[model samples]
Target chain A: MSASLKSLPSNPAFTLPQSNDVQGTTSASGPHIPAEFEQTLTLLTSHRSVLGYLLLSRSQPVSIIRHSGVVFEGEQGRKYAHAVGRIVETVQAGLEEVAGESTDTDEIRFMRIRTKRHEIMISPDERFLLAVLHDPTS
Target chain B: MSASLKSLPSNPAFTLPQSNDVQGTTSASGPHIPAEFEQTLTLLTSHRSVLGYLLLSRSQPVSIIRHSGVVFEGEQGRKYAHAVGRIVETVQAGLEEVAGESTDTDEIRFMRIRTKRHEIMISPDERFLLAVLHDPTS
Candidate 1:
């Protein structure tokens, strides 16, 4: 597989020296992620199959909140971010169309795209979107 | 869930009176689908959770090869088909962009997008693309 084994924190814009302790702490990234979420991130990266994950703010401009894994770094990371946002938007629109018109409760909950090499799992909340890339065969 | 329970054959263009056989038979659908695939379809529809499936040919004008389930019927079915094709194309392009350039071996094998109500499983081959919609909670 082309994906790297080690998980790394790769934020494109902010280069602030961060704290290693995740207990009850927030991400240094743009959004004020909850302490529970930060703890969840700690738990997610510990798994063997999880290659990396990207957390994004779904507000205007769509910024990255936090990311893990080498595949979620630099230019490749940006592409993944863009694709995750676009796919969620597209699928939400498509679902509305399928139902004949837009409805308030028709919000998307989760999505998983499995490629030949990796699986991209996404979860969307009111303010945040999380995309996790994992190798199922691992 | 809004999805209907019964599985029905829903093809928009050609609705020939079909043969209801599973043993060593080809589909009445176009593009010469193999007997093994038709048998597989039979096996798939037998499952309790699988609400429906759509099989499409990836030719110049993508056409529906075979479809099962009420969610895959009529105008709604058309919407699903169009969305499936578009999503596949978008994801493929996104993968290429992630890789920085196009490669021959970067073909998408499978994709699963789980919405609040349904789960869509897609498998792409050299000639056909199969999309199966199932209720995971069921």
Candidate 2:
């Protein structure tokens, strides 16, 4: 994953809309994803199988930092975001319960969910949660 | 996955303890996993990286049909089972919401979650839910 991020350092054509103004701003309102991360999103969405991608702030009152494609537009985006939050929380809590400890070292890294029509790949971190939906068979 | 099931027909040495009594019973009380599934579980547990697996009956009361390894023993198994239910439900609901329809055609097929120490793979169906936990690095 880090290799992919480093691969595309300055893909101007792939620069995201939100990254334009909030390049380095880390306001308390929401997270400030690095330019490399945005490039990675762009690279991921460029795949023919990929339908869209959603990047969310993982802090309290999770917020959508950036979203791409039609599937994650309007109310549907909010619904998917909420689902992501719940799924992450459930898995993290379950892991902690199994370990019987809440150590910082133990945390979720990735999730891949395959449905009838789409495959959702999620990368979760301390500050951001990224989900990419794609057609696996394609 | 299907190939693995076909590989093992009856390995008495690896046959789970439950399979001995509930070989061909599918009572309304709980799910009746086929003999092949039990063999698959046996095959999976034989892997050095695998920590455990939980096979749950996805019915009204969601009972555990079979579980392997110490990681999934006792109350810990119950917690993981509950988490699986919630994760499946949340993802299924989110998919339906995105499609804007409650079509039976749209449903979750599989989920793989990765944490710091373990990688959990879940296969959910109408009658059964199976989860396998393993150490990815190993």
Candidate 3:
């Protein structure tokens, strides 16, 4: 919580190599779910007890992994979830261009999205984008 | 709308140098609204015509900017905006630790936060965090 802008900034290119330090976890193929990650998600979900949360990659046609949170009302939450992914992707692409084309400017890292009924939290990586959905009211 | 996990992966390490390319921007103290940044926000606000938006420094106690966008509801909205900044700070801290401690297994990039009546969009940086609020139902 004491981090300053000088301390952390986002890179324009998404090119981090995934670490293979995960152990005792089985993976069928790509992107192993680290024990620490699952633990963090479990802690957050239980402590926050949010409406609904999801873990999706930032690539095109986002792939969602483990997700547990309240379903947005009207099942519209699903659409909103998908829409949010696309929107963030677009924004990232734009920011990348802006960072390189114009000049070293606003190096955007993560984005916080608030709608009428949802609070979408998005965190980025060179490769993946993590989004969490919660109804702040509940 | 077509971002896939394989297509987009997180980059390793949180190491991006901050840019000092801001020009012709005078700082009376408060928040130094860079000319280009201000222009970008203005364009986004004009095109989106979103509810009032704010740019608050991620530092403790929070430093707010004279921002554009649709104004938030009333006094309550103002308080919520402040609260949102703190909440995001906490979340980012937690996420940062997760990224470093857990290994590159899950390199989280961005997060989307949703509440009962409002939607908050957050963009992160080592230096600053950007947050946008809007009514999802509206």
Candidate 4:
């Protein structure tokens, strides 16, 4: 019951793993997922893992879950995921403008397109995507 | 001489040379006297000459100039340059928050910084440093 976990609202759609279960693998009981869906799920799972590492290193109580094809929360507290998502979106849009695209006025500006060399990773719960926006200029 | 030229407003003291004058070499009696100043002046001058070529090809007005011994402007117009400076500052702040040091925010955040390379020949008039802000992401 860390402060961050206490801050997030409980999401019944996804189960909250105990502190020890945070690193457990996903069950292989589900149907064979499409490659695209699997890729997206892997990205989300990776993102959750990274975030989990960050939070755990900070001794924060926040936990992330990727399920139901989307990343969600299991804590019974306040969630700052929306804020983090917005920040990611802002960075993506800035990258697009630098790329000479006119995405300043569009919400799709934040959506990172899949590329051969670069990609976004998701978790098993499908709660988040580890989106890596590369700056081709450098 | 125009009033702006006489007083030389320090904010954007540099000006773009006339199209015809963009090819001439710096005069022996140029205003910058010190060797370091002369070298910088030479660099700035050369930039102007290169910009002329780009302007001709792209049909776009691009210029660069030093201001107050600290600031430098790159291509993309007045508003865009200022916006870039602001974005640089913002990214610098964000990086500091994440990394705890003043890293090269320009390199990490925008593809425009890559265009800052590419040496150019200078013109006589110490007005502008013309270079392309090529979209690196493209």
Candidate 5:
């Protein structure tokens, strides 16, 4: 996998120390994120099934940052952060089956799957991958 | 991280050689899946944004099978099947932060997150977890 496995801080202390404070990095990258990402987040959160979301940039530094729009904390926060990176790698590796000869539409925009106890949602682009975990029953 | 890394068959040939036919094992386990699980799958697929879904059991055998209620196939089929086994393992390892000494309520039932390009929805239960992957853009 090309992704780095750096663990995100349990809190905000893990912010990058470089000239780009977390917010600057986030906004500069924010335009790259689509508008619908949050619209869907609103839909899921309104349903109360959503736990939280993590945004990971594959560009560099391999960041595992939580979505500022929602309150994702504690053990659950860390778990989603970790899952985002792995999911991106897995999808990237697995895409060989679909990419075919068309290089233009090679990126994966979204994916959803379930485990015995929880649901996982993922959206990816050239620069970052976004994942949402939620349950409709809750 | 208690999740077993057992690989789900890349193809149907990997079916458990242990006296279980494909249909037999599914029906034996089918009773555990919630009606709400399918309901959500229907909702997501109905939306043009939905790409596909994979439902996996946390119990042994790490099956990466799709539900009978939903038709998940084509290029995405191969991708999610490949993903199921790895995702279960990832989530299990990631859950350490939240599954504390608290009561039943401490565990998360549902979660949703998104990045700029995609969205992932997850619903988890004691017996299994259901995940739906979709794009609001599509």
Candidate 6:
């Protein structure tokens, strides 16, 4: 696993030094917010599954701002329970088929499998994940 | 100056495992592009000034991209010029007025100031800044 990992070449890996930091000020009175932030937010917001995964993993409700600039806050986990639950249900069914019983052992195994899938989806965009976690109420 | 820098907290940094090297056999398969590549392109495309700074410091162009989706290609010098230009036009403008010199040297400095500003505003986001020894554009 260690052999497969590639390192990021840049200094200050995730933290971007904005114009304000470079100029040593609270804000740089520029004509516009840098396009990068806008693009990043767009990418993050575009993926609904990522948002759903976040809310589920954090075990917290979240608000998603639509592309039209309207914000919608809700318990995404509860709302998407059917789809996600179906996935969980399917996994449970598979385990029962193999093990011939829905024992305590099967429940634990199913939970681990579900958790692993959720983790795999959420692992890649850690910065966006942090941003969502750190989002101030709005 | 270095003493003013704050140290990061003792939390272990998260590491993402890379499954493949550059141009690896792993094919892209997902609802979205691989997060690693998405981040690299996003960082490169978005933070032109930072890229410029890196390029300037290195004095040579570099190219990077992996099967994971990160792609960057550019010279450091050009990026530096753009960053310097942005700094001059935006942050350094106030400083220039404070200095208040209208000599030929001052005019040359002012022209340099304007050129950097213009380069950042007008250039394509993906285009690399090329450093010219005598001419600002060679």
- 1 or 2, greater by TM-score: 2
lDDT of 5 by residue, A40-137 (tens): 44544443455666666665434664463344565455555655666566555544433446564334544544444555556565556566655434
Question: Which 10-residue window in model 2 chain B sums to the lowest lDDT?
Answer: B6-15
The digit string of per-residue lDDT tens for model 3 on B76-105 reads 345544554555544444334433444542
Badly placed stretches (over 4 Å) of model 3 are A1-30, A72-78, A100-108, B1-138
What candidate 1 gets wrong by more than 4 Å, as runs, is A1-29, A102-105, B1-29, B102-105
Instruction: Kindly give the stretch of ten consecutive residues in candidate 3 chain B with the minimal lDDT sum.
Output: B8-17
DockQ of all candidate complexes: 0.50, 0.52, 0.06, 0.04, 0.14, 0.01
Q: Candidate 1 on A27-48: residue-level lDDT in tens?
A: 4744566665776687678867
Model 3 CAPRI rating: incorrect
lDDT over C-alpha atoms for residue A78 of model 5: 53
lDDT of 2 by residue, A83-102 (tens): 78777877777667666653
The C-alpha lDDT values of all candidates are: 0.68, 0.70, 0.47, 0.28, 0.46, 0.25
For the second chain, the TM-scores of the candidates in order are 0.74, 0.76, 0.60, 0.29, 0.51, 0.20
lDDT for position A50 in model 2: 68
Compute the lDDT of residue A3 as modeled in candidate 2. 42
Q: Which scores higher on DockQ, 1 or 3? A: 1
Candidate 4, A136: how far from true, in Å? 13
Interface RMSD of each: 1.5, 1.6, 14.5, 9.8, 6.0, 28.7
Could you tally the backbone clashes for each prediction?
A: 0, 0, 73, 27, 40, 8
Preferred candidate (lDDT higher): 1 or 6? 1
Q: Residue B128 CA error for candidate 2 (Å)?
A: 1.0
| Candidate with maximal TM-score | 2
User: Candidate 5, overall lDDT?
Assistant: 0.46
Q: Which prediction has more favorable lDDT, 4 or 5?
A: 5
DockQ score, prediction 5 = 0.14
lDDT by residue for model 1 (B4-114), tens: 332221221112112233233434645676666776687778877888889887764557877999989987787888878877777877777787755643557676676
